[model samples]
Structures are given as structure tokens and as C-alpha cells.
Target: MASLDDLPLRADLVGRTPYGAPQLDVPVRLNVNENAFPIADVVADDVVAAVREAIAGVHRYPDREFTELREAFAGYLGHGLDASSIWAANGSNEVLQHVLQAFGGPGRTLLSFSPTYSMYPLLAQGVGSAYVAAPRAADHTLDAATVTAAIEEHDPDVVFLCAPNNPTGTAMGLDVVEAACDAARGMVLVDEAYAEFAHDRSQTALSLLGRHERLLVSRTMSKAFAYAGVRVGYLAADPAVIDALRLVRLPYHLSALTQAAALAALRHAPTMLARVDELRAQRDRIVAELGRMGFSPFPSDANFVLFGGVADPHAAFEGMLADGVLVRDVGIPGTLRVTAGTPEETDAFLASVARLAPSPRP
Candidate 1:
């Protein structure tokens, strides 16, 4: 078998690794911050029926515009957005890819704070856009002045903001978002992938949409909706922005089955999200327990918690993995991330932490 080096790979992709987390099968899996609750049976039945109905017409290309799905999303997002301001793709990844392909290319640049989603740079690299990883405040928070300063210094063609940011679950304030939208000379993308898990979900960038035409807020069904496998993600922006994405999107980008299933899921939104409160409880439990155990857990508005102060992040990870538990060792010094799942899952993780990741020495 030929190694990757044997092929004429893109020069920029040389030595670059693909974005992924461990897919290890375990009794309790929390590495990826996935919503651990199963979908309600009612929602599942509807999804199956919807997919079955879609299968009846699979032979035809899906509604290329995904018109109804967009409308459904607009209704779900409810910021006075219509189908015209909506865009979607296979997942948030593809949605971001479309953004890059449309607004980014050879000579353009994408800027974002560091220790973010980890995929921003890859997406930029994929589109031949330069990726800028700027620093955050020491405590992993950002204020308006800091955000605007970075925007001024980079003068990037696109600014990516991951709210309730990954690996460290801090949500960005609307003030900072406003500043970035005001400062960036080009596009501003606020990724709210975990917005539903935030304590105050109402404090979203959606409020700033009408004011900032350049702003785009991206979201996914993977986290709060527990629809990771369904692979539905979308964005809300000015109608003109949607038109730009249309130029770069693949024809029939979303399949009939996808459209149908997502629409069905939207219909039972309240039921589908029934466990969100419990999940939030679990997240808070993780934070409080970690603090009691002398680990410094960051404040999380997402379904996961990123705790630091571990003496050996890998050792703690392996120790937990040994006990049939898995958590993320997101590559920050002394830090590890764990998703808040069911109470049972949280018990297993917290127990594992007590055994392997004891209090660090002062």
C-alpha cells in the first residue's frame, strides 16, 4: 500500500492531520460532547415515517432548494428570519465549508480565537484561506475591546466566533460579537453549535442579525437536539449572504431523506429537547464536583465541561478510559473535557475522576 506521501497531495496539506476525536467504543462515551439522551420514541417514529416517505421519491433529486426545510429552520430559529435568510448543508462543517468557498479563497484569510472548535483552521486550509489563531484573555474570556483589536490587526476576510466555545465552554457576550461585526471588514461567522445548552439561550447572536448584514450565525442539531447522526446544520444571515452560499453549494446538497427527517424533528422540537434541563443539571454538577475536587472547571454554557488543573491530562484520560469511561483530552496544558450526559454517565465519569484525577498540589 502506498503511503499518503506517495500521492500528489496538495502542498499545503502536507503533514496536516485530519480533524477527529477518538471513536473508541465504551460503556460511557463523553469525549465528543454529544447529547447522550436518546430521542423520544415519538420523535423517532415520526423521523422513521418521514424518511420512509422520502424514500418513496428517492429516485428523484431532492428539493434542490430544500425550500420547506429552510422554512422549517426559519420557524425553529424565529428571529423574524424567513427562508430567504437561511442556508444549510450536511452538517455545520459543510455549512462552514460553503461559507469559506463563497467568501474565502486564495488571498483571503479567516481569523478566530485560539482553542476554538479546532476545525476552523482546517476549513480555512481546505478553501485555500489563511487561518489566524488569535489569543484569548488568560481566563479564556473575550471583551469587546479585545475582539475589535484582533479584528483590526488581522483585517481578515472572515471572522469565526465559536460561542459557548468548544473545549472551554464559555459563551461570548453580545457586546463582543457586536464589536467583531463592527470591526471586521468582511464576513463574521458566529458558531452557536452549543447554544441551546447555554444558561441564557436568549442571549444569542440572532439578536444582532438585522443590524449586521455581514454577520452569520451557524447552528447544529448535534448537541442540544441530540441529532448528531442526522447531520443537520444551518445558518441564518442576510438574504444576500444566502445567495452567495447558493453559488458555492453542491447541487441538491441536502437529500430528500435529510430534509424530511429534519422537518419531522422540527415538528416535535419541545419533546426532542425534553432532556435539555437534565443535561444542564448534569453540566452544572460536573462543574461543582470538579471544583470540590480542586480541579478548575471552566464555566460552561454548553453540554460539556472543560476542567483543568490536572497534573497529567493524558494520564487522567487513560485512567478514566481504563474504567470504561472516555473524556476528551483537548490539547491544552493541564486540561480535559467531559460531556454531561445522563446521571448514570456523569456518576461513572465523576467516579473515574475521583480515582484518577485527584486534586493537584498547590
Candidate 2:
């Protein structure tokens, strides 16, 4: 067998590992920020029926445009959006990869904040673009001034703004989005994969789409929709931005079954999202309880909470895993991130923490 070192791998990727969390076969899995709730059976049945119906057309390639699915997504999003402004792929990750392919490459640079989505750098590098991890505020927040300054300094070809950013679970104000759109000399992508988990839904970067052509807001069904296994992600942006992505996407990239299943799920959008409020409650509970337990939990607006004050994050993670609960050790010293799942999962996580977590650092 040949080793990776012996193969002709790209120099940038030679020593890099794939982006992922530990997928342990534990009884409790709050590690990946997934919607731990099972899909409503009625919705699941509809999805299965849709997929079965779609199987009849599997002999042919799917609709290259995925028109009806885009229309469904538009209706679901409902900020005066239509199919012309929607683009999707296997997941939000691929949707982002398409954006990088269209806008970032060898001579271009991609910029994002540290402790942001771990995949940003890998996606940029895979597209042959230089990646810059800009510094965030002292409290792990990104302010408008910091964003504008980074864009001014790097002159990057692409900028990623992960709203309600990952690992930290810190929400970004739209002011920061406004600053990025104003300051970026190139494409600006707002990753809102966890938007549904936010406390406020009235305003998002999506609201700014009519004004800025470079502004792109991406969304995914993998989180709040309990559709991670279905692999459906889409974005809403200016038609021109959608056009740019169309240029780089593979032919019939989205399979018919996926489109059918996603469309069926969207038809039950209300039912699919019924647990959002409950999940929000769980997230708040984690934040509050962690604070009461002497750990410092950040004010999160997403479906997960990132708490600090662990004496040994690795040990805490290991202990929790051994106790049949799994949380993410996102390489942040003194911090660990866990998804806000069911009430029972929360109970298990808290119990494991009480058993294993060390005293808070004064």
C-alpha cells in the first residue's frame, strides 16, 4: 500500500487532515451541532413517497436547473425570492465550494475570522486560493470595524461571514455584514447554515441582497430541519451571483431523488421547524446551566453553546465520551462546543459534565 507522503499530493494539502469531528458510536451525540430530534413521521413518510415517485425518472438525468426545487426553496425562504435567485448543491459546503471556484483561485485570496468554520480554509485551499485567518475581537466576536479593516488590509478576492459562527456559537450583527459588503473588493459570502436557530428571524444578511450584488447568503437543511442525512443545501443571492455558481457546477449535480425529497420536506416547512423553539430553549438552558456550574458559556443565538473554563478540554471531552455523551473539542483551549438536542440528551450531557468537569478557573 502506498502512503499519502509517497503520493503526488498538492503541497498545500500534504500534511492537512480532512475537516470533521470524532464520530463516536456513543448513545448521546451532541457533538456535530445536528438537530438531534428525529424527523416527524408524517414528513418522513412524505419524503419517502416523494423519493419513490422520483425513482421513476431516475433512468434520465435530473432537471439540470432543478427548477421546481429552487422554486420550493424560494417560497420557503420568502424574502421576495424566486428560482432565479436560488442555487443549491449536495450540501452548503458544496454550495460554498462552487462560490470559491467561481471567485477564488491561485492569484486570489480568501479571508475569514479565526475560530470560524474550520472548512473555510480547506475550501479555499482546494480551489487554489490563499487563505487568511483574520483576528476577531477579544471576546471572539467580529465587529464592523474589524471586518472593514481586514478587507482593507488583505484585499481578498473572497470573504466568508459565518453568522452565528461555529464552534464559538457567537452571533454576528448585521452591521458586520453591512461592513463586509461595503468593504469587500470581491465576493462576500454569508454562511447562515444555522440561521433557523437564531433568536431573531426578522432580519438577516438575506435582507441586504437587493442592494449588493456581491452579497451571498447560504443556508442548509442539515441543522434545524433534521435533514442532515438528506444532504440538501441552498443559497439565496442576486441572480448574477446565482449565474456565477451555475457556471462552475456539475451537470445535473442535484439528483432527482434529493430534489423530490427536499421539496417534500419543504412542503411541510412548518412541521419541520416545529422544534426550533424547543431547541432554542435547550440552547439557553445549556448556557444558563453551564454558567451556574461555574463554566463561562457564551451568549449563543444558535442551536449549540460553546462554554469555557474547562481545566482540560481534552480530558473533559474524553470523560464525557466515556460516559456515553459526545461533545466537540474544537481545538479551543478551555472550551468545548455541544449541540442543544433533546431534553434527555441535555440531561445526559449535564450529568456527564457534573461527573467529570473540573473546577472553574478563578
lDDT over C-alpha atoms for residue 290 of model 2: 86
Lowest lDDT block of 10, candidate 1: 353-362
Stretches of candidate 2 exceeding 4 Å from the true structure? 357-362
lDDT of 2 by residue, 195-289 (tens): 99888876589889888989999999999889999898999999988999989999999999999999999999999999988999999998888
**Alpha-carbon error at 48 in model 2, in Å?**
1.0
lDDT of 1 by residue, 1-362 (tens): 99999999999999998889999989999999898999999999999999999999999999999999999999999989999999999999999999999999999999999888899999999999999999998788878998899989989999999999987999889999999988988999999999999999899999999999999999999887889998999999999999999999989989999999999999999998889999999999999988888888999999999988889998889999999999998899999999998999999999989876565445
Cα lDDT for residue 248, candidate 1: 96
Residue pairs clashing, model 2: none
Give candidate 1 misplaced runs (Cα > 4 Å).
360-362
Indicate the TM-score of model 2: 0.98
lDDT of each: 0.93, 0.91
